[model samples]
Target: MWSLALLFGLVVCTLSVPTGRNSPAFAIEETAEWIRYEGYVAETHNVVTHDGYILEVHRIPYGRFQTASTAKRPVVFLMHGLMAASNCYILLGPQNSLAYNYADAGFDVWLGNARGNKLSRRHEELDPDNQKRDFFDFSFEEIGKYDVAQMIDYVLEYTGSEQLHYVGHSQGGTAFLVLASSLPEYNAKFASVNLLAGVGYQNYFPSLPLRTLARLTNTIYASAVALGLVEVAAPSFFRRGDDDSIINAVPEDEYLSELSTITELLRDGADDSDNSNMFGGAALKQIAHFGQNIRDKTFRRWDYGLLENRRVYGSVSPPVYDLSLITSNVTMHYTVSDVLLDERDVLAMVNDLPNARARKVAREDFSHLDFVAALDAKELLTDYIIESTVQIENLRSTGK
Candidate 1:
């Protein structure tokens, strides 16, 4: 009876129209609603970083089906990719959601939203709206340094665990790499690190337009910053539309066919009507940092031009992030069809890391977005994540 009721409720929720507002209020409410409907425990915590940005974190201590146990469970930290918040992990619903799967497996799950996104928009002294430049002054470097470090420390303190497992998608993985490389001491805090379609060296961005944009990113971002537009939506130019936009530019038949293909890849028979809300705002500098990586073909700190670079780093160019400093067990998962991150870049990253291995996704058609939204992600990605966790536990028990 309960199962039938849940099914009915799900159908009702799916049939309802999602709100079109792109505010944090809607995102928070939607996340909470889904958590309750799925019968999961939702806890929201505000973590203040050393740099003054306040990040909003979401946690699912355990699945609804799990019984309360006195034994402390291993904790897993899941971070979202570029232009996405912690809600991405939970957007796929309970049966296929990575967060729910981790909780059901008896692992404590924590999801982190990077700064400038809807969830982590607050700061100690700066207002995001009025003080645009100060609010959005950071790039992925700051995210890795302050945001990731603080969240990990808070989770460790909250869970009373000596070490935790980390699973990062795209920029999430990049931030972890930054954290591990820049702050080598934090390497001891992680039992293992899993990077899903994570990129470090990005010389092979598959899209022609993106490659072209990378060349102009510095100019574009600097102009935007100068114009007092710091907080901007990533890929904001091509969201959804019935005319003029990329989606509308395609003919009706071709667009429908393409939509079908994408829907199949992401939704995998699940409703995707609410996916529009998943995308949020990010710092312009963050996007520019990625562009810098593409143009320079090196995973290094953000370049503030030659003059400013010398002022900041005492060098004419930014220093490269030393991947060798990462001593934690690292596993990378990539798909051949990921346009954003090329296989060559992934190989280059793997070659740099002292303790790293790379695995290609099972499907050749898997794209960058599939890591989070694919229907078969459980078999292709989540299983590997679970296996990695088990391996970490076994290694710990063996004193290795």
Candidate 2:
């Protein structure tokens, strides 16, 4: 039995889902184009991590472009944010995205899926079907230290490069900070780090409705876990499918209806001619880190109950990491419109890094997902950043 206060709070969460009308209409043509663009021919190579977890590595051909070969182009390891997969860089609806852009620009691209995601769900001797084969014994801390460190080593070994560059979006960015703090030896292996819409300081942004819900829900989640309703923490989106929202303590059918309502909000008034879902379960989890980033201010980590619960919590998020000793050459990018992570909080993380700087995107109305989701990323964002990054790398190289 649920209390009225808890029920009402859940209602508030559903009602507040932002409508699609608020955003500029997504272009159907662009969506079609994105659907058609060629992704790198990826080869799967599995690596066993120090902790006995297995990670799936997708290696895109490095020599497809001449620029990468001629310049001895540096290898870049790409890590997706929370529940997302490596596919995110490929599906931005026709606008040339970073995944393609970096490959086109001659850098060897390797997109990493965090452990427990659909693609990276593997352990050495454990069967996923076994009841024991659920989302357990994992958190972002494991990702940052063991998963990332191993992937970094694998990329260097695969590319035969002594050093590599890194780019992490949202939680991906946070993971590297964790890596730096715990496995500082890996720092020497990376040349630079590009943090897109990162999270480290929670106090820097304005209070949003979702942030408030997170505070409430975090407590609810703690209680739910205690009561053995651990699945409530997983994000409801997985079950909702094309629906609007999830019903707390309700049947799947009713929850599906609410999910439909939320979907309407996400797809409001768009040319019904063009209804495209550019994100997947893995990708959504990747981005949810923006919220978790806020909830776990100052490096506290979260358990993975929210991600594992199939019925209740589709948004089972990983724990927050303590980043007190993250000392890396890091550059953070922020746009005025990124509602998920405000510029102030991103900058505060920049301030914390031993060697860090901040870059503000010229436009304001950008949301957090736009860093990778927007169709115009290559033209509007990454190219500029890459050009400047290369120049900066050059200057540092000469100085050294």
Candidate 3:
């Protein structure tokens, strides 16, 4: 439940779902086009995972004011959370968004779209909308296992860099832990990892109403999946649309300007003929995976129940994702008011992570959406994160 995105997404499901993943209207405006629209050199890269999910990645090779340089800029990969496409990072526009801010800071920025989103919906042998049920048979677990792993390798290989800085929000961070824990070798591939309200443990979800809702949603999705609800696509009511105005929780006093910016961005995207969804698409399993965590109160693997667990894990229960295995330099950002992530849960994750620390957002009222959507967020937090990554790179380059 991405409070900001999901809340509005629920209301804005009015943004008509395209019958297919690759509708002509859907494919026209991608993250790269958004990047180029801002007068930056944007490169679109199609990275195929081992499992054949072709991920759509956008790159800002240099800053808006600066041209490509002989000196190779350090690369920073920005991943979106569930129901969000990479566009979320840039939708706030230049100077205010993460993708643009990282570029303006001279680091090569890569915006990543996970499978099931509008951008990365293509798979080698599956049609997402043509009754290919297996196409939707994945959760964040598979996302971490295949999607994140392949994208990371592709970025490193393309840039000829040994490691890159990672900044992921919510399920984005969840996928990183999935990769690092499942494939421990990938631990060495990061200069640093930043999780914005990164969720791995949910023993103490702050909101009772939302948690109860999540439990019901989880059961509904899981039951549906078992009964051949594998292919979750259009004509579907359970869709996530990306209009942030669906966010009704932001504190009135603090977010007037930021909320205005959000509305304006919505208007710009709403052409008479084009009802582009702010969020792309995600599998029901993705929601189910998070619901499992909220229900089970652990940051472990998917709970396939008894029978499927035996077939999948050779046991009656799924294995846990060991945060201890994620040895990368990790920084977690949490807020007192982020109903999705409690401070206790964040600390538990911090304790479990072998090499990790935690940062609390000063705005105790910061919503989960504020981590990604608020313009004031960078000043409250991300600026320091950017500086820290830069310093780490400086130290590495100088062999300090």
Candidate 4:
């Protein structure tokens, strides 16, 4: 049994690529009305960063229909990835994605939108419409250092708690890493860290199509920046709700067709399908950034257009953050068939953290989207993570 468990961990690390080969075969059906997520109500609050950007916070109260106390229920503040809105967690709500599962497990879930997106756009005294350039002016550093830190402070203040468990996916994970490194003061604010296909180390694994696109686009972006085309941001193609299998009740045929488009590969060997399972347009841009990161073997400064648009004028470009700050005990979970992030890359990331734990999920033919959207994910993917996180939290509390 010990040997099998070790082998499975390695297998999960290997299949983090976007290829459909050797993916998981099971599908999970939704039988419950997601853990009491009331969706975004009219209640709006402001969280100001030390740097001066005001992030809009929307609280989705626990399902009043269910019996649960909001007092000290271990609040979880969720941060979305690049180009993704907090609604990213909404899709997972219908059938009890992590949002539902965690809430059902008795936690007050807080979904956060990074600055510059659709919902979180607001200025202290200025309007985002007049300051369109300020809207797009940021990189992962800003999100990690400014946005996340502010959110953490806000959650702690509102909940009257010192720390809350942190969960981030992809860029969300990157932001958390930055917080741990650049802002070590906030390290103690997290009870546990859960990284879903996050980026920390980017060696050992390669996605062909995406790498090709990054190489090509970086050239285009660099040239555009040089030639006064600094107003451009990465393309946004993938949008939320594109993958309804996890949220709405889409037919299997439609789901497969959409999945094929989103999971299709580009020329260099990465999944370059036109239809992304997440938010559209901007998502492709985010992927393009990841592709570039993989090719460059380093995190990058923010694009001028993004920097200027997001309204961070005269802001110093963030350097590639040191990864050693991510020394908190972290558990990484990946599937073998993920094309964007491969198992090799996952292992590389794990090696970078001084105190990191790793686990792999089975996807004999898993694709990148299968981690969240595979109909059977609740049984296969999420259950493992849910169980693992609970175990980690318990261990943290008990020193087990």
Please name the candidate that would achieve the greatest TM-score relative to the true structure: 1
Q: What local distance difference test score does each model get? A: 0.74, 0.56, 0.73, 0.54
Give the per-residue lDDT digits (tens) of candidate 1, residues 184-227: 99999998899998868877777665565467667766665655
lDDT of 3 by residue, 1-400 (tens): 2111112222111132222323233332465766776778989999998888889998899888565688889999988887677777775567667888888888999988888877888999888878446788788888888988889999999999999999998888888988999999999999999999887888997767656656565456645555555532322223123653333222331222233322433443443335446646677677777777776778778887799999999999889888888899999998898757789999998998889999999886887877777778789877988889889989998998
Cα misplacement distance, residue 13 of candidate 3 (Å): 14
lDDT pick, better of 2 and 3: 3
Estimate, for each residue in 211-255, the C-alpha lDDT of model 2 and write its tens digit: 554545445444533443322222333233334343444442242
- Residue-level error in angstroms, candidate 1, position 129: 0.8
Ranking by TM-score: 1, 3, 2, 4
Higher-scoring candidate on TM-score, 2 or 3: 3
Query: How displaced is residue 317 in candidate 2, in Å?
Result: 20
Scored by lDDT, model 3 comes in at: 0.73
**Pairs with backbone N, CA or C atoms under 3 Å apart (clashes), candidate 1:** none
Model 3 per-residue lDDT at 217: 51
Instruction: Sort all candidates by lDDT, best to worst.
Output: 1, 3, 2, 4
Model 1 whole-model lDDT (C-alpha atoms): 0.74
